[model samples]
Target: MKLRIAILGTRGIPNHYGGFEHISEYVSTGLVRRGHEVSVYNSHNHPYKDDNWNGVSIIHCYDPEYFLGPAGQFVYDLNCIRDARKRNFDVIIVMGYTSSSVWGSMYPKNSAIITNMDGLEWKRSKYSKPVQNFLKYAERLAVKYSQYYVSDSMVIKQYLARKYAVNSRYIPYGADTITPAEREQITPHEARKEDYFLLMARMEPENNIETILEGYNQSNSEKPFQVLGSTDNRFGKYIAHKFKNDSRIEFKGSIYDTAKVRALQNNSYLYFHGHSVGGTNPSLLEAMASEALIAAHNNPFNQAVLSKDAYYFSSPAEVKELVETVQRRDTEKLMVSNNVQKIKNLFSWESVVDGYEQYAMECYLDFNNGKIIS
Candidate 1:
């Protein structure tokens, strides 16, 4: 079925930002390729200002987040929803509820709203108590306003079902199986193949960046630990200062070059994933696809994805042990191979797009048949 679909809640496409933007880029274009009419709401300040991208329509809305701070996200989301109300889209997918759910009532009444319930936002260590409460309220608003829900991890799906009495479709983020990059691809970063430890994540408290760095510092490994992501934020600056004396730890400030990033992941001796609050993080999927032996934060979300395929760590001590003990043993090689296979069988971009498409069609059918109302 060819449905008119609208996607909201990310900064923009071409993935200049984080997870949702990447998902928007892939899902919007993928749906278009499947003969559906898809439009993605992009921020006016987005790098790509074109009206269309790869056959998918790009609706740019003015965003004031730069000047208004967190309050600006509400304005941006309001603009997107107001514009969506006029588009007459058959299905409107809301990527995350942190900012947009407050304006949920403004979403078009005739459209089938599907909210992708992002990680438990209230659990993040960065937010204040009041902000966490507000996020909880926002999550409830999203659940009340949407006719359907999407959970990227089975754990999240179960959480929504248990907490809100709602059954959400499980649709994970995806990554392509990466071809190992040439050694030269990482030479510019001063990294040699299989000679460095790698980590890629936003510098947030919940991401456990400090914990991972502390663990790396405690270990006696000779390999340099490369940290990727912007360090302009408060937490970033603090961590950078705390680890300033550690010559072995290098902060490679945000690297957006996908090929280079994948090369680093592919060539690393071990990739540390310290995200503690997200569901099926795109970085973890990318690491797995890149055949990186992962040392992931021990949590239901990460466990669900990696299963028995990767090592798990809960604290700095555990991370230190993994860092010092992990080697190119036959068991470790098997773990890397198993992770790559998981990506191929479960987390491929094609499968992710297919899940979204199928769920969207089901929701559209139910909406038209009076089984779903928003």
Candidate 2:
């Protein structure tokens, strides 16, 4: 069926921000290619001002998050939800429920609301107790209001089924298989192939940036540790201040250039993934696709994705050990090759979009046939 769909809950496309924006960019464009009419909600201030991108309709809604901070997200989400009501879309796929679920009652009743339950937001140390409680409530509201749910991790899917008695479709995020870039591509960053450690993530408490940096600082390894992502936030500033004296640690800031980021990942000695929250993180998939040897945080989500294909760490000690002792063993080389194959066989963007398209169709049919009653 050529369905009309609307994607909500992201900063906007071109993916200047985080995971959901990346998913919105790929999934909206991909669905459009499959003959579905797709619209993505974008913040009015988003860099892309065009009303259309890659055949996908763009809906720019006012976003005051810049001045309002976190509270602004609630307002932005309200605008998206209110706008979606008038569009009469067949499917309205909400990327995450953190800020939007509170207004769940406003979601168009005629449309099938399929929400992607993001990682455990309430568990993040960044939020206070009250905010965490609010997030938990918001989670429940999302479950109560949506006709269907999508979990990007199998672990999250199981959690939803066990907690809410709801079966959510497990659809992992995707990454393109990166071709190896020239070694000199990283020269401008003063990084040499297989000579520097790399990590790319937002400077959030849950991402364990401190733990990773502490471990790297503890190690005697002379290789520079390149930390990507913006450091303008409070946590970012604290991290910078705390580790300023470490000569081997370099805060590279956010690099949006895909080629440069992929080049760094493709040539790094080891890639550190410290995201303790979220399911099937895009950065992890990208690192795998880039053929980087992975050392991911020890958690059910990361374990489910990497299995025995990558080293796992939970503490500064573990990270320090990995950084100091890891070598380019034949076994590690095989692990890198396996990660690439996983990306190709399982986590490619084409496969992820296919899953979304199929699941959306199923949800739409079920809703129309009364198989799903919201």
Candidate 3:
């Protein structure tokens, strides 16, 4: 059934940010293609100032977060919710609840609420004890208010089930395998092809950026290691200071250009994924889709997705050992091939979109029948 859907959270479409924005772009457009009316909320300062994106309508709401700092996020969410309440939407999907859950009651009662419970945010090392406690409280409120929940990983689904005694639907993020033509568009390598390893993630503590850099430093490998993403934050500055003397480590600040990023991933001798807190990471999936030999952090979330196809590391020592041991580029050729096939069959955009569409339909039916799925 074609239902009126409104997607809240994230800084809006064309995905200049993280996973939620990425999913919002794909799912909103996909729903529109399926004949459903979809409206995505965009922050006033978003780069894409258009009234519409693809077939989805964009509602620009005032976001004071730029001037307000951390507290500004709550104001932005409140503004979005206030605007959303004015319009009647059949289903409202909120991506993350670090700020939005506080305004849960402001959502329209006529609509069904579905919250995508992202990885345990309270567990991140970046937040202080007080902020972590607030995050935990926010998570509880998000679960209590929403009619249904969506988990991006099986691990998160299980957490919701055990902690809140609520069943959540598991729906992972999607990725596309890079085409040879796309590689050609990015052009010949500025960095030597397959000579350097790659690590692309936000320079956050929970992302294990420092650990990865330390591990790379400990290893005697002569290959250059390219570190992508911004290094201007407090922790980033610390990492930069600590690894400043290591000439092998090259910090290439956030590469948002899709073609260039894909080329880096596709040609890297090895791709390092050190994210410890999140569910199925978009970067890891993107690296796999690029057929890059991966070495991810050892965790249930990463393990569930990569299984036995990817090498896993925990400490700086382990990462160092891995770097020293896995010398050849094509050593994990079989695993890389397996990862490529996994993306086509399981993590494709079509499958991910279908999963969301099916869940939305089910929630809509339940809401219409005066039944709450939660």
Q: Return whichever of 1 and 2 wins on TM-score.
A: 1
Q: Backbone collision count in every prediction?
A: 0, 0, 0
Runs of candidate 2 with Cα error greater than 4 angstroms are 180-184, 188-191
- Enumerate residue pairs that collide in model 1: none
Model 1 misplaced regions, further than 4 Å: 180-184, 188-191, 372-374
* TM-score per model over all chains: 0.96, 0.95, 0.96
Question: After superposition on all CA atoms, what RMSD does each candidate show versus the true structure?
Answer: 1.8, 1.9, 1.5
Model 2: per-residue Cα lDDT over 276-355, one tens digit each: 88788888999999889999999999999999999989999999999999999899999999999999999999999999
TM-score, candidate number 3: 0.96
What lDDT would each prediction earn against the true structure? Answer: 0.91, 0.92, 0.90
Q: After superposition, how far is residue 18 of candidate 3 from its true place, in Å?
A: 1.7
> Candidate 2, residue 202: CA error in Å?
1.5
Sort by lDDT, best first: what order? 2, 1, 3
Q: For model 1, how does the per-residue alpha-carbon lDDT over 236-256 read when each residue is reduced to its tens digit? A: 999999999999999999988
